[model samples]
Target: MQRFRLADLAPAPWRNGGGVTREIARGALDGATDWDWRLSVARIAHDGPFSTFSGVDRVATLVDGAVRLESATQTQAWTTPGEAHGFAGETAFTARLDGGGARFFNVMVRRGRLVATVVAHRTSGVLAPAQDVQHGLLVLHGRFAVETPAGTERLEAEDGLLWAGARPALRATLDTPTGCLVEVRLSAPAQTDGAA
Candidate 1:
């Protein structure tokens, strides 16, 4: 298990070099967010044009402030941290801020290769049954404790924990009102022997 603090997150320019993103963790240590196995965390601060990523499945959640996102088919309004939006990273879209600016939490994986979900739970609750894939939890708000078969540890916003190999037992409880959670479940790759 690893812990990340938003206050400690480092921001960098987006892959497209348009805005900025905070890469929390990736691959083995976390999860890879590339053609093979892509997974990453980022935040957006400005409202401008939409950036496109090829062949990547992505989920973006509103952490702070309000953001309006538009796609070819429809437009989405993410007003609170609990609200999450899923899309094809390759799709064209733009982010329009309602005010000064907004902060977002994002996760991405290879398209068609894996499935992911983003959800917000109350201060005290347990995740429903999750099978077939690995689980990753990213705390979006407040300080909380994650109790798994391994043990219990405190997690602040931006902190993450991974339960891989097989489905593991887990639960979370927040100590504050600003608490939110983002859950990710990714499929494992099939093994194949080299050509004979």
Candidate 2:
């Protein structure tokens, strides 16, 4: 098991010229591969247009202030905390700020082929052992500690964990505050741009 710190992550521009996204963790831990699923932690600093992804499934959850989301057909405003929505990656979407800019956590996975889920965990507990799916966890917005055969590592807001290849038993304890949980399930090998 490997742990990533939020403060250590560097924010970069979003792919395909969309808004900026801070890539916290990704499968294989390398920036080259076109991963089957990607876990990105980002802050929507402004309200404007968004980019379009043709073959991806996306999930967005608000972790901070109120914000509004608009697509080609509908416009919805998310004000409450932990409010999340999913959309097709091919569609064009834009974000409109309500009053002030808000922070949000986003997860994008390849549609039909790859599967992913995002959960905001606020209670104090431990995660049970499970197998069968490739998993990755990102600590967003709280202090959470994970224990494994390697050792104990504490994750603060914006930190992430990337796990691939095989399943290994792990345990976690939340003694600090609220945090977000993310896991990904992939079916095929990662696609490369040259092959496509």
Candidate 3:
């Protein structure tokens, strides 16, 4: 398992003045440009439109301040911590900050190439073993413990663990009821994408 820290990630500024995106992990085929999926946390420093990703599908969770997300189909206001929302990456989406600024977690998957899911854990729990799957565990806020064959991992806010290839039999538990942990599970299509 590989651990990643938000503070340790390099900030990749957006071409426009929206904010910066710090990539946590990405799965590629042959090259970097051929990535089929990516997980990252982005800070919305200003209001702006999102870049279209053509064949990609994305899930966004509001992890910070207030913001409004508007798309051609619908508009949603995130006034507080809320559930994750999924949308077509090709859709023309725009964001408007409600107050100071906002930050969010994003999971993007190439349509037909891969399948991905996200679950927010608010209390202590055990995650049953999953076979032939890749997993990403992110502690959005609060103290948590991840138990695995490798050993127990202690994580704090913005800390994460990303693993590829073999799926581990593991369990995660929040230190308190006030904690939020996000789990992302990914699988490839039967057609394959060279390697995960």
Candidate 4:
């Protein structure tokens, strides 16, 4: 298990200059321009078109405030706190804030390389690990604590924990009844025999 402090993540401007994003983790295939998967949080301060990612799949959830997404076919889809929306990265869309601004947690995966699910709740219980896949939990609000075979760690707002390989059993307890959890699953690459 690995812990990532939210304070340690540096915010960077988006390529389209529409918002600021803080990347949590990223994986690539042979150092290619298109990454295999990426997890990040974006702070949208104004209305604008979302950057296109070609063949990537994206899931985004609002953590604070609210926003309305507009597309050609879909007129308007509103996302409030803890509400998640999934879409193809190639889809052209624009976001308009309901009020001041909004913060969103996003998970992006290359079309054929990975699949993911994100859930947010206000309760506490056992966090069963996913079989044959990577798992991660991010605290969006309040205080949360997790107990694992390795040890126990407390997570404050925005902190995250990532576990890879064999998933370990863990228990989660929430100090307050408000928080968000993100679950990500990576697809295993096909095995191949040694060949020229």
| lDDT value, candidate 3, whole model | 0.83
Q: What is the per-residue lDDT of model 2 for residues 41-117, given as tens digits with 9 covering 90 to 100?
A: 66676777766678888877776777777887987777865667777877777888877767666777766656665
Cα-based lDDT at residue 181, candidate 2: 51
**What is the descending TM-score order?**
3, 4, 1, 2
lDDT of 4 by residue, 103-178 (tens): 8888888887777777775678876666745667788788888888878888888888877666766788888756
lDDT of each: 0.70, 0.65, 0.83, 0.78
Model 1 superposed RMSD (Cα)? 4.8
Lowest-lDDT window of 10 residues in candidate 3?
76-85
**lDDT, model 3, position 79:** 66
Predict model 1's lDDT versus the native: 0.70
Candidate 1's TM-score: 0.80
Give the per-residue lDDT of model 1 (tens digit) for 22-84.
666555323544443444555555766777779878887777788888877879888987688
TM-score of 3: 0.90
Candidate 2: minimum summed lDDT over ten consecutive residues — where? 181-190
TM-scores, all models, native as reference: 0.80, 0.76, 0.90, 0.87
Model 3: per-residue lDDT, tens digit, 10-62? 99998887899999988876565788888999999988897679999888887
Q: Flag the better candidate by lDDT, 1 or 3.
A: 3
lDDT of 1 at 158: 70
